[model samples]
Target chain A: MVAHPTRDRRAERREATRAEILDAAWELARIHGLAGISLREVARRIGIQPPTLYWYFDSKNAIYDAMFAEANRQLLQLIAEQEWPTEPREMLRMAARVWVAFSTEDVARYQLMFQRSIPDFEPSPEAYAVALEILQTMRVDFAAAGISDPAHLDLWTAVVAGLAAQQTSNQPGGDRWLRLTDEAADMFADHVLGTTTQESQR
Target chain B: MVAHPTRDRRAERREATRAEILDAAWELARIHGLAGISLREVARRIGIQPPTLYWYFDSKNAIYDAMFAEANRQLLQLIAEQEWPTEPREMLRMAARVWVAFSTEDVARYQLMFQRSIPDFEPSPEAYAVALEILQTMRVDFAAAGISDPAHLDLWTAVVAGLAAQQTSNQPGGDRWLRLTDEAADMFADHVLGTTTQESQR
Candidate 1:
């Protein structure tokens, strides 16, 4: 059956509007945190009445779901697009760099995916599936690089998640935290891949 | 200088009350979350007028600082008291267990120390000194185990910190996240000790 031109246009408009609302919500949530956000606040930021947002999103949680999915998608895309090195040490370094860069660039997005608690909210199956895909990719790459231990994978994932979470917290000093994070990442890479370098040379 | 008996009693009572307030704040913060808490709410929960809270803490940030210091002190004490194993692998495993267990038991306290932001607060010179001592101990142990790289210290710290942070955020039906953390910790231990176990065999 041929779709009507008016219906197709309405569908496109609806999608665009949804994206606009989500973008607004993401920015507001970042500034005020997850608890500080509401549908009315998001709509106000986007220059629309609060109820108009309901047309596109069923509720604030719906918007959160969409925002989270988008953020995860972006992170996975960053990892996917990297040109990984063949050496195990270099591969590990590349993974750390990608992970840190993605997290630093999208602090709010990262928080939504990992930090905040949203009551009664279940991420769409697709989101969890994609997250697993990212983890699996890391697992496969690490294994191919001769990291055949299950324990190593567990540690790697935990450390990576920890660093990501740390980026979102209200730590005391910004410069110190950044230095610590970079130093920590470098150390983690060495531990995982056993790279030989002056810094690694105790 | 000799103090009066009544003065001594009052001073002791004040110290005890302050400890009670800090303990209550830590518990409430954990349940309601850091951002969700207010000074008034904390005071109310402790059965004191909000203004009276100032008799002990100058502000909520001050309370947070005390809580953070207390948590760090406990963690450092736990780390200091740990008995190193004869084998490097066993030592690493023990360290991971102790770190995870400490953070798990006092999750709110851990969050206060590492997870939340406190503006205008710096780690006291004493706290900084103790933190360095803990790192030094870790470095010395790793070196003795033939893991000569000092970088491993940073990686291990990040791994432990990350695991603590993630476990705090894990929710009901978050079995996948929990399993991932456990696996990650095991992998980290193997990476540190240069040993592979059956779990890593897969």
Candidate 2:
């Protein structure tokens, strides 16, 4: 098939507009609560008529789905970019640090991706697949440490996310909870890895 | 001061109205997101003019504060009412069950109490004091298990809150995360208490 230059340019522009709409929605979410996003307001901010906004996103929930996928992709990129250590325990700790930093930096994004703050917004399957991929990536890290139980993965997520939630919720712009990241990862890691004797001293 | 029966009756009615307003707000939150609540909508629900709502709550955030305090008080009551096991480890596990149940039962309440979902809503000092008291009560439990380190308490909270967050966010009305409550609690418990050999086998 021959490449159509004009159609390619048009598609590029459309994709850019979608990104703009998503960025504007995130800005509104930061100001209003996540669920507080109004489509009319979003349209107004992006200099589009309220009805015209539908061309890009059919509904507010559609916008949410895009944002969900975008956030997860950023997470995927972050994980991919890290020079992950070969030592499994160190890798787990590094993952915790990366997640906490990512979550606390943009609380609105964190709530959207992790916290179910939006009442009716469930990520579309395509978007949710990205989240599952992130989990699978972490699963391999846990498996490397000889912690193969699925329950431990659930526990690992709870611990690290709890740290992020605490940091974002209680001590925003502070490290009270963020500072606990390494220790928390080590604690859970040691617990599941059956190496508790040394860590118990802490 | 001398008791005034008529004044006391008037005060009782005023308090009753306040409770009614809070209940209405909670109803709205269940339907809408927690931060999606509106002062006007609340007034309409309870058959009062929007302006009249000021008598009970000076602002929407005030209603949120009242709700925050009320939610924590309920948590405090829930903890107080538990038939806490004398065995520290048993008590800890029991506490996890209670918390995850309390949290997943009503996600709106959990978000208000635990999650900073409402961007600008900060609980009043009195309300936060109740939250702190809940933490202090749990501290006694950790202390009983000979886990005197405060970091352990933070880890325990992260672990448990993570479970609640997981249950409420990922598997609402499902036991996927809820079923992990005892194991999650025990993982952290044994990690801090130095009893990992038995649990790691799982």
Candidate 3:
């Protein structure tokens, strides 16, 4: 059966409105800390009644889920689009830099994804899948480097993400942690990765 | 000069009250997220009106500052009370475990010191000095370990703090990162610390 033209046009309009609301929420979240934004303020910014927002979003948590999913989608695209180096160490180094850069780019998004900023909020399964996909990408990279152990994966994430956390928390746009990114990548590649079968193979 | 008996008694009472207020605030912070507590709630818990709280803490951020200072003092004490291994690598392994344990033990304190949870809340110079003192102790340990460069210090902080963060945020009470603490400490000792002169001295 052919889709009805009016129904399709109406669907497009609904999608456009949802996108507009999300954009406004993110803009406010950037200024206020991630937990600072409220549904009322988001609605006021977009000149919509709060109830109208409820029509699109079940609650503030739903909006958070959408935003989280969107952030991951952007990250997935960023990773896919980058020209990665072939050498395993170089690639991990590049990955570490990108991970920190992505996190620091928006403090709010970084908090939402990495931090339990919102009380009583858990990402919906569909939204969480996006996050899982991002983790999967990292796992694949680790596998490529001949490191498949979950413990190693956990340690690498802790090291890489820890630098980003320090950079964003202590000194944004500063070289304190950012300068060490390359050095750190080298350290992990030499120190941590050496324990892995990958470097042992070399 | 020797203090008068009356003045000494009054000073003791004041200090006692201040400690009581701070304790109540921390109890509430643990229940709510670190940033979630209000002065009113703290006052109510301690059976005082909110205005009375101002006698001890000038404002909410002042309370946060006190809390931050208290947390660091505890850290300083914790470090001092422990007997450290003489072996450089063993000391680092112990240090890594202690750091993660300290951080996860009190999530509220961790957020205040490291995560930047409170908006517009900068720790007062006095409170921050305590923090600096804590860092200075870490520096002394690093020096003893023969890892004197600021780069090594930065990397070490990232790795230790990063694991604490993952443990608290992703898997509190689970050993995903905690279990790797020994192995990670070894990795740092072998790779990063081995590059230092202290390890060579061994």
Estimated TM-score for each candidate: 0.70, 0.86, 0.92
Q: What does candidate 2 score on TM?
A: 0.86
Docking quality level of the chain pair in candidate 2 = medium
Instruction: Give the per-residue Cα lDDT of candidate 3 at B175.
Output: 76
Interface RMSD of 2: 1.6
Error of 1 at B185 (Å): 9.4
DockQ of each: 0.27, 0.58, 0.74
Tell me the lDDT of candidate 2.
Answer: 0.84
- As for candidate 3, its clashing pairs are none
Clashing pairs in 2: none
Give the TM-score comparing model 3 with the true structure, all chains together. Answer: 0.92
**Residue range with the least summed lDDT across 10 consecutive positions in model 3 chain B:** B193-202
The weakest ten consecutive residues by lDDT in model 1 chain A span A170-179
For candidate 1, give the docking quality class from DockQ. acceptable
Candidate 3 structure quality by residue, lDDT tens digits, B73-139 = 9999999899998778889988988888899888888898899887789988999998899899989
